[model samples]
Target: MRQRIILDVDTGVDDSLALLYLLASPDAEIAGIASTAGNVPAAQVAINNLAWLELARAPEIEVALGAADPLEIPLRTTEDTHGPHGVGYAELPTPIRRISTRSAAQMWVDLVRRHPGELVGLCTGPLTNLALALREEPDLPRLLRRLVIMGGAFNHPGNTTPTTEWNIHVDPEAAKVVFDAFSFAPPDRRPIVCALDITESIEMRPTHLIRLAERAGSHPIETVSPADPPEARSVASNPIIRHLTDAVRFYFDFHDGYDLGYLAHMHDPFAAAVALDPALARTRPATVDIELEGALTRATTVADWAGIWGRPPNADIVVGTDPVRFFDRMIARIGDHARALYPGQPVGDPVTRLR
Candidate 1:
């Protein structure tokens, strides 16, 4: 059975890669894409959505814009990671399509209501949209099949701050609201929270990019451009890919600065991968909570169920990753999908061999 999913993303580089993987995968059907303010503004997020649809050639799928800021504080954008455009440095032809009339939060609520127990919600950004939807439609959670979120820092040091992950840090109140609403139950009703430590540990080395490029061929560039031919569109039309490509290029620059060229963390893609194929991810039951109040620890997520820490585990936490095996599997799957989609394209030698 194909998994029916609605991707709520900030269109970060890794988020773009995840979108690409979904477009290539055979197990899922993207019901819609809802954007929220995070890596970029809500407006740009809407633009990124159009770019993605143009690239993926799947404009038929619904795309809706969501919240511009948190329910409380003013919005904060991440130009350092995703670039000024929120998609990174990669440029493409202007998106030809306009956004759906409905807002992302409304679309989410409606989708869940209509689908009823068949929709898997994949959220890879700030929790604003999800929180708003939950607040508006109290019954939405009961209708959802499952929810996969990519945010929070369990045991590891935070990426955005010393104690919090970016998505949660952006809006801990929103995070708390959503987590409070959703309940996880092992293999069935669990809300999979892919944290920073786990995802950062899963790196997309130069070898993987080369493999992706090889498989993707020249289609990626053309696909991302709104003016690209219809046949060239697919997952590449995903703004997530455009942003990812931009981020990869930026990462390359950072790598060069530090003499570590082309190495990039899988981050959002890894989280999406776990949601797409949980069998590939290793997880354990642990209590998790978002720390709403603390001068130094604001927005931090505490995960320590029993002997680990006094804090009870609120949600199932993803802690470990089989890096070597998982990367190989991801590369294999992406390559196969790329080849099938863009045949006769040259899969050049990997820029750097996988370690």
Candidate 2:
């Protein structure tokens, strides 16, 4: 049976890749998509959702826009990472599809209630929407199949600062709320968070982008096309390539001196992967606490209770991943999706897909 899932995302460049992976994976039955305010404004986040879904040609999946801002703090935007349009420097084709009138938090709560214990919440952005849903319906903890969050950095240093990932740093209060809400919930009721350290280890390098480009070939990319050879004549174009290329390029330029530049870590995708295949990850049972009031450590997640303040490790921390197996699975899946969506190129064999 396909795992029923509701993806809570911000539709950033990475989020777009995660969405593509979710829709392409046969194991997941994507119930819907909920947008949040993090990488960009909530409005644009909603707009970007339509473009991405249209590109993936998965209109059957509902797209709902969530919280416009954090629960307590003022809205914060990240133009540096996602750019002004919220998808790096690339411009995706504008999708005419309208966003669901229902609020994101509402969609999330209603879906969970509708599905009862069958829905898995894959959150890849700030925790505001989840927190809001929990606030509106405190009993939701018992109904969810699970909560797989993509945020936080335990032993590893944070990306945004010395101690905070962008998602958590965007809204520490919201993170605190979500973490605290399920901290003491029964094992079956709590959420599982995939931390940054584990996620950063799974990457899609520039070679991967080149692989996608090679699949696209000389044919223009933007619209849907039928399956064919790598050098086959084009039926339509694929738009995701240009934007994704620019995003990867921007990412590469930003990490010029670091090894991270070789590949862009699909942090959100790996988190979603854990939800689909728990075997991809080895997790440690512990309490997770988000520090909110710390003068300097605010928005940081701590697993153990030391001298610092953090929520109890209510959620399991993913510490290990089989890099070879993980990469093989991911490349195969992504390569298939790229071929299916764009058509042409090497459809089989990851080893020769890029060549």
Off by over 4 Å in 1: 183-187, 217-246, 254-262, 307-313, 336-343, 346-355
Tens digits of per-residue lDDT for model 2 on 145-238?
Answer: 8888999999899988899998999999888888878866778666777888888787766566655644544133222111212232222234
RMSD of 2: 5.8
Return the TM-score for candidate 1, rounded to 2 decimals: 0.84
Can you give the TM-score per candidate against the true fold?
A: 0.84, 0.86
Q: What would the per-residue lDDT of candidate 1 be over residues 36-140, giving only the tens digit for each residue?
A: 889888888878777766665653777789887898888888777766776556665588888889989999999998888899889899989989998889777
Model 2 residue 36 CA deviation (Å) reads 0.6
- Model 2, which residues run further than 4 Å from truth? 213-242, 257-260, 305-313, 344-355
